[model samples]
Target: MPGSPNVLDLVHRSCTDVAAAHAEHVKIDDAAVSALAAELLQEREDVRAAVRGLPLPIKFSSLEQELTLLALYHLLDFGSGYDPLLTKTSGGRDARETLLFGLIGLHLGGTRMDHHKLKSFTMYDLYTTFNIEATQEVAVMPGVTMTKPGPLQPHAKALLTAINESGAALEEAGAKSPGELLLSLAEGLKKAGRTTAGAFVEELIDSLPGFRDSVLYDGRTLTLHRRAQNLAADLAIVYGGRDDRFAFSDVDQLAADSGATTIAVLRAKGVLQLSEELASTIDEGSELPAGPHERALRAAAVAACDRVVAAAAAQAAGSAEAAGPAAAAAGEEGEESGAAAGAGAAAAGAAAEAGKEGAGTGAGSTGPAPFRAVDVGAFLAFLTEEGRPLHGKITRHVTRDVTGY
Candidate 1:
C-alpha cells in the first residue's frame, strides 16, 4: 500500500479505464457498460483497502457520499456519461463557482457542504471554487479586497466594484481585516437576500468604526438592521435555531459589555434609551446581551442609523443642488465651516476656535470666513456643569455637534 497509488487516483483511473472498455465493447452488448460499472466499483473498493496500509489514506463519510451522489445527479442532468452539474438556468458566475467547488468538494475526502456551517473545506474545493491565479493576483494588489457575490448572476459587477472601493477604507479603520471583511460582504450580498445597499452596510461595519460605533449605539437608523434581522431569521428558519442577538441577552448586560457602567449609562450615552418604568421593568427580568457576535449584531443597528443619516444628507444635498446658486454657496460654505459633519479639512478652523473666537477661510477666499469655533474642552466644561457624565469622557474631543467640526 505504501507504493500503491492514492485511493482517489486509483478510483478515477479505474472508472476511466472501465468507461473506455465499455465504449470499445458497445457494439457487442449493453451488458458491457453494466459490467464495466461494476468492475469500477469493485476496483475502487480494492484500491481503498490497499491504500488503508498507507499513512496518507483517504477516508470517507456519509455526508461526502451524499455530495458525490449529488454530483453524479448533476452530471447526469447535464447529459454527460459522468455526472456534471452544469445548466443553462444556473446563473453564470455563481453557478460556475458553485458547480466547480461542489464537484471538487465531492471528490475531496473532507468538506463541509452546508453554507450555514462554515467549517473548514477541502483545499481542492477551495481551488475549484476560487480561481487560484485570480486570487493570487488580487492578494498582491496594492489595496485590494475580494468578495464572493453569491450564486446570483446579476450582481457580480456591483459586488466587485464595491469591494474595490470600500475595501481600502475598511483596511484603514482596523475593524475587521480587509480579507475577512471583503468575503463577509460578498456572502451578505450573495446569500442574505437583501438589497445591495444593505449588504454595503455590513461591509461598512467590517471596514469603518463610525459605522461600527453607530451600530452598537442604535439599530433603528438604517434598513441594514432589518436586512440583518431578515438574514438572521432566515438562518433560524432554515437551520432550526435562534440567531437573533437580542434574544440572547438583556439590556443591562449589553450596556455593560458595550463599555457603559449601567443601563442608565447606556441611556445617557445614547446607546440605549427607555422610559424609567420600562427600564426598571426590563431590568427586573430581561435577557442579557452576551457574546461578541451578539454585541456586533447590536452594534449593527446603530451603524444602520448612521447610514440612514448619511443617505438623508446626500438626499438633502441633491435637493439643494437643484435649488441653484444660493444652495450651492451654502453647501460650499458649510463644507469649509465643518457644517458637513465629519469633514476633516475644517479641523484647522475648529482647532483655532477651540480656546478663542477665530475666522475660517476657504481655498479661494480673500479674507477670513466667519465661522464659530467653539472650544470643545470648554464645551465639555459646560456639559460637566449640567452634570452629564459623558463630559468627563470627552478627552478625544470629537465635535459631533454639526454647527462646527
Candidate 2:
C-alpha cells in the first residue's frame, strides 16, 4: 500500500492541474511535486491508522471512516485531483497566526504541509473545528492579550469570512467547485437547515480522540511569543511612521501615546488661534478679558500637554520595567530631568547610545530605550484641576478613536 498506485503516478493521473498550477504559480518543480505526493500518501495512511487505533468512546467507528473519506475527497476535490486545502492564501500569519492554526489550538505534524492543509484534513481539522466550538481566546490585539469569547467567536467569524472570500475569489478566477464540498457533512447540514448547525459543530468535539491524549498538535509555536527587536521598524513599515507599537501587548501603549499626541497637537493649534485672536483684540483697543473660545482653547492646550507628558513618562516606566534593576537604577537618577518623549531628540539619542553600548549583544538589540518615571496619578489630578471646565468638553469633540491595534 505504501507505493500502490504509485504516489507520483497518482499525481500525474489525478492531479495534473494542481501540479501544473504549482509549477505555474508557485514555481515548484519536479522534486517539490513528487515530494508532495509521497507526503500525502504517507500521512493520509498514518492518519487512517491513528483514527482506527483511537479508543473512540462512542460509536466513533463510522465517524473515523467518514473522516478519512473526507481527507480522500479533499485531495481529489480540485481538478487534476490536487488537494485544494494545500494552498496557503497568505504567507504571513495573523491572530493566532491564520485561521487554520487558531482553530486547532495546536500546530501538528511537520510543516511540509503547513502552507496548505494535507486535505480538508484528517482529525487535525476536525479537532480544530471542535476547538472552534468551545470558548477560545480571540486576539483583540496581536501578541498582547487575548479576550475569551463564547462559541461562534470572532476568530471563527473572521475565518468563515476568509474562507467564503477565498471560494469567491477562486470562482471569480474562473474555477468551479465541481460540486465537491470542503466537508462532506456541510452540505447535508445546510439542507437539514440551520437548526442542526449547532448540533453538527458540537458533535465534532465529542468525536476528537486526539484532544484527550493531547497529541493533536505541537505547542511550541503558541507558547512564550516575545516581542521581536525589529518590531518597531516592522510596524513603521506596515503602518507608515506612526507613533504606535505592534507587539501583541502594546495596544494600551499605542492608545495612550496616540491620545497624548492628539491632545498635544489639538492644544497647540487651538492655543495659537486663541492667542492670535486675543492679541488682535488687544491691538484693536479691546478689553483683555478672554472669550469662551479662548478659555476653552487654553484649557484644551493644557490638557493636551499634560497627557503627552504622562504618556511619555509611562513609556519610560515600561522600558525600565523591561530592563530590570539596571534600568530602574539609571532611570531613578534621570527622573528629575523630565525624560519624556517630549524631550524628543535627547530621549532617542539616549536609546541610540544604549544601542552602541549594547552593540556586542546584537544589532538592534540595544535593549529598551531610556525611561523616566512619572507619577501618572498626581499628574492627571493636576491636569484636571488646571483645565477641568473644558477638559471633558474638549474630549467630547474627538470624532474617531480607533481601539483595535
Candidate 3:
C-alpha cells in the first residue's frame, strides 16, 4: 500500500482543488470564510465545552460495550435526507436525535452488540427499535384502505443494509463487535509504530464499506469519509485521556464533517456561494442527488473549514505572542498579578499548541485548547441546529438514499 493515496491527504487536497476550481454550481468565498473563522475563534471556548461534553450520560457496563454502541450509532448515522419523515414519525425528533433515541433504546432493551445479532436484524426489528410505525394507511378506493410502506421505511431499509453489511464484514474479520474491530485496528497500527488519527480513519475506511464515503468528480476522487473522520474525532475527544487505545498522534490532521449540514451552514453564512439554479433547487426542497452540484458544495465546505482552522490557528498564535509582553509587564506589578499572568500565559500557550500538529489530549496536552477543523465543523452544525433562531432558518440539502452522511 506504499503507492496508495493517503485518505486524509486526499480529502484535503481533493476538496481544496475542487473548491479552488469553483464549479459552476457552487463557489467558495474567501472573505466570508475568513470572517466566519474570526467569529468561530471568538466562540472557540463554547465550542470546546460542547465537544468535551459529548460523552453520553448513560452508563455502560464496560468500555467495550460503550465503544461498540457508539460505533453502531455512527454506523447508522445516515438518514439526514429523511429528517422530515423521521420528525413526523418520531414525535418531532430530527434524524440524529431519532437515531440516538433508537441507539439508547436498543441498549436499554437488552439488545447485545453482537455481530450475528446485527446481521439478523430485520426491517421490522429496526422499526420497533427506532420506535417508528412500520406501515401507513393508504386509501385505495373510497372507504377501502390498504397498507403501504411508512415514510421511514426506506430509511429503515438503508439502515438495515448498512447494519447487515457491517455485521457480516466484522464477523468475517473475526471482530465480535464494531468496538472490537476498532481495538484490533488500533492495536495493529500501534504494533506497526503508526498512531495517527488518519491511520485509524483509513483503517476504518478500508475495513468498512459504509466508511468509504467518496465520490468521483471530474475524474478526481474526492475522499470525504465523513463518518470515519467523525468517529476518529469522537474517539479522540471522548476517550483520549480515559483510554490509551483511543489516543491518536495526529488528530489535527482530521478534517471537518463533510456532510450536507456543514454545507448548509456555510451557504447560510455566505461562506459558500451557490448558483441561482442550485440555490433555487435547494430552497425549493428538491432532492439534490450525488453529483456535480452536491460534490462541489461538500468539497467547498471542506476547503472552507480548512481555511477557517488555519485562520484561527494564526490568530491564536498572534494573540499568544501579543499577550507574552503584556503578561511579563503585569508580572512586574505584584505576585498576584504574576500568578494570574502565568495562568493566562499557560492558557495561551495551550491554545497555540492546539493549532499545531498533535496538540490535543490525544497528544498529551492538558490545558485549554484552540480550534480545529472538527471543532469548527461541530460549531457550524450546532449553529444550524441550536442557534437557528439567532442564525436564521437553515435547511440542509436533501439527498435521499445516500449513506455518506
Please report how far candidate 3 places residue 359 from its true position, in Å.
6.5
lDDT of residue 219 for candidate 1? 26
Q: What residue runs in model 1 are displaced by over 4 Å at the alpha carbon?
A: 1-265, 270-273, 285-348, 351-405
Instruction: Write one digit per residue (lDDT tens) for candidate 2, span 183-229.
Output: 33333443445212122222222222111100111121110001111
lDDT of 1 by residue, 1-405 (tens): 224332222222332233223332111122332332233222322211221111212454542243222322221111110111123223322232434454454448354333222223333333354322112122446697554433322222222233233334544543233324433544455454432322343443444322232221122211112222222222222222222311211110011011112222223334333335434533454322332222332232222222222232233233334444433445676656445433332433333232122121111112221111011111212333336545434211111111100
Off by over 4 Å in 2: 1-106, 111-130, 134-150, 153-155, 163-405
Q: Against the true structure, whose TM-score is highest?
A: 3
Backbone clash count, each prediction separately = 21, 7, 0
Q: What lDDT is obtained when candidate 2 is compared to the true structure?
A: 0.27
Lowest-scoring 10 consecutive residues by lDDT in candidate 3?
A: 358-367
The estimated TM-scores of all candidates read 0.18, 0.20, 0.86
Winner of 1 and 2 under TM-score:
2
lDDT of 3: 0.77
CA lDDT scores, all candidates in order: 0.28, 0.27, 0.77
Model 3 misplacement above 4 A: 1-3, 53-55, 133-135, 319-369, 385-392
Output candidate 3 Cα RMSD.
4.5
